[model samples]
Target: MKIVADLRDRFGVEPILRVLGVAPSTFYDWLAREAEPGERELLDRGLLTEIVDVHDRSGATYGSPRVHATLRRRGIRVGRKRIERLMRAHGLQGAFLRRGWRGGSTKQNPKATPAPDLVDRDFTAPGPNRLWVADATRIVCGDGVLWMAAVRDVFSNRIVGWKTSDRCNTDLVLGAW
Candidate 1:
């Protein structure tokens, strides 16, 4: 529309409007809108400014919901869908935690035999070392991830054996015991 306004003097209005596929009545209506802005247009324009500020302050991480919440906290009453519409029109978006689709991380070996459940869901033990349960966890370290494997004696309610390593696998668990 602005291009049509600027180049209309040089090339002419109808030619540019025809080339741009915009109706003459639509262009004239736009001119009238510029002359006297509608209430919704005025409100949307003001909201756009506030939305941009909130988005920028969040380092462009916040989406329409967060932006709307911030506006409401600051005593600005506006609908979330309206913020979404305005942000979409202006090409604004929140940062995504994950950019694209990814497959599951786990893969089981088809040929590997399953371990028998010796405990059979029962954890009670009358004496120490009669039964032990093990668990493994990974901790994010500065250099790398640390895998920790631990075994607990049910009777004593204490850790019987434990081990930590950079690599996590069956060997680490077996070695921990």
Candidate 2:
């Protein structure tokens, strides 16, 4: 909004962005659509309606890439980046990102309890039962998540104790016990 107001007021983008703590490169990206045909560049009411059409036909899951592809297939020839900028200006966006595996933290906390770097980092133990280890992991099914608790006998490398439950309450661990 600030950038748009700045561009509208002075016919320049860089200075306003600088005054408002935005980078010049971002303003330049917004200006990339300046090369489009005048009518298409404006993304007026009719074009905006069409953009919404394209966006919705995709179940609202299409970002500019898929939206542009859909438009191109329908005989519209707009750059993907241009579509992106127009979408931003109009406050239209695709669905939020789909959940995925949470990235593991990488910061080595000097104060964090340090695992003895087991297997000497080998990650491979020669014999089972030699290294009894236990762990609890979670799995998500239709309705809710289930916690799986297990103890592996390092000597025979066999699961000696195992339990699964929808809850990880003490009872669940006791059940495994």
Candidate 3:
């Protein structure tokens, strides 16, 4: 629309519209919208103000879900998805609170000492055998779960060795090495 408005004076409206493949009615509608925003846009602006207010009232902790609930309780007819879109567009976010906490399956024992980061965040090695990283993970099969361990050479960026077992233990990792 801005392009058409700018070039219409030089090329004429119909020619510009023809080249741009925009219908005359569509161009006029865009002009009307620029003069006065559509109803939905006005509603969105008003709703954004209310959303900001609600977020402030909650110490900026109320996300779209909570804001939508509050607005509904106060007799406002609004959709949760619409509230979500507005909140997201305005960069409003809520603090993440996990509903349930379950420990990971591969958690290291507290008594065990963690392996030193020998690579120091650098994976590049001068030679193939100089740096070999190893990792192990559990995989589920048709019958049951299996543990897989792998050793990769940093220089070659290839798997040097790998092994799979029904049980995850030191033997499985050592077998890969």
Candidate 4:
């Protein structure tokens, strides 16, 4: 239909419509249709603008579920599927945080001697402060990456000390102790 309309002046509407397998009367009816936007389409345009605004304000980290929730909070009544369709239509996407491998290798080092196991898989201790377990992890935050060290008393199964820093080093472990 669109091709026939665009090429009507150049090659004539009859030939174009015949080539495109569209009848002349059908094309004429479509061309003579109302030019005004439908009510539902107008409402969708407004809703999409609001959705884009919310998505932008969230740093593009909000998916349809979150976007729908935000819209509901603002007193906008809409379904999750509708929001998803609008987002997909406009090529709007959300940022996803992925968890990568951060554990030690399974294979042991040939040159390094293995340290003696103090706990020997025994996590319980007689009392607090008797046996403490420590570990460190890296957290990705909005500002930057942060290093965290935590010390837990095995007996109480509670964290006794903790420390955080921008850099992961021996001092972080020492501070947690």
Best prediction by lDDT: 1
lDDT of 3 at 97: 57
lDDT of 1 by residue, 1-177 (tens): 889889989999999999989899999999999999999999999999999999999878899999999999999999999999999999999977576536433577999999998988899999988999998888866566899999999999999889999887888899889
Q: Top TM-score: which candidate number?
A: 1
lDDT of 3 by residue, 1-177 (tens): 899999888999899999888899999999999899989999999999988989888878788899999998888889999999999998998867577646355766999988798879898999869999998987866567889999999999899999999988899999999
* Residue-wise C-alpha lDDT for candidate 4, range 10-73, written one tens digit per residue: 9999988778787899988777653556788788999999999999998888999999999999
Model 2 clash pairs are 128-154, 128-155, 128-156, 129-154, 129-155, 129-156, 130-154, 130-155
Q: Give per-model TM-scores.
A: 0.56, 0.34, 0.41, 0.55
Per-residue lDDT value at 19 in model 2: 73
lDDT, each prediction: 0.90, 0.71, 0.89, 0.88
TM-score for model 1?
0.56
Model 3 per-residue lDDT at 31 = 90
Q: Which parts of model 2 have CA positions greater than 4 angstroms off?
A: 1-63, 69-76, 94-109, 127-177
Measured over all alpha carbons after superposition, the RMSD of each candidate to the real structure, in angstroms, is 6.7, 11.5, 17.8, 6.9
Candidate 3: Cα lDDT at 52 = 91
RMSD of 2: 11.5
Poorest stretch of ten by lDDT in candidate 4: 97-106
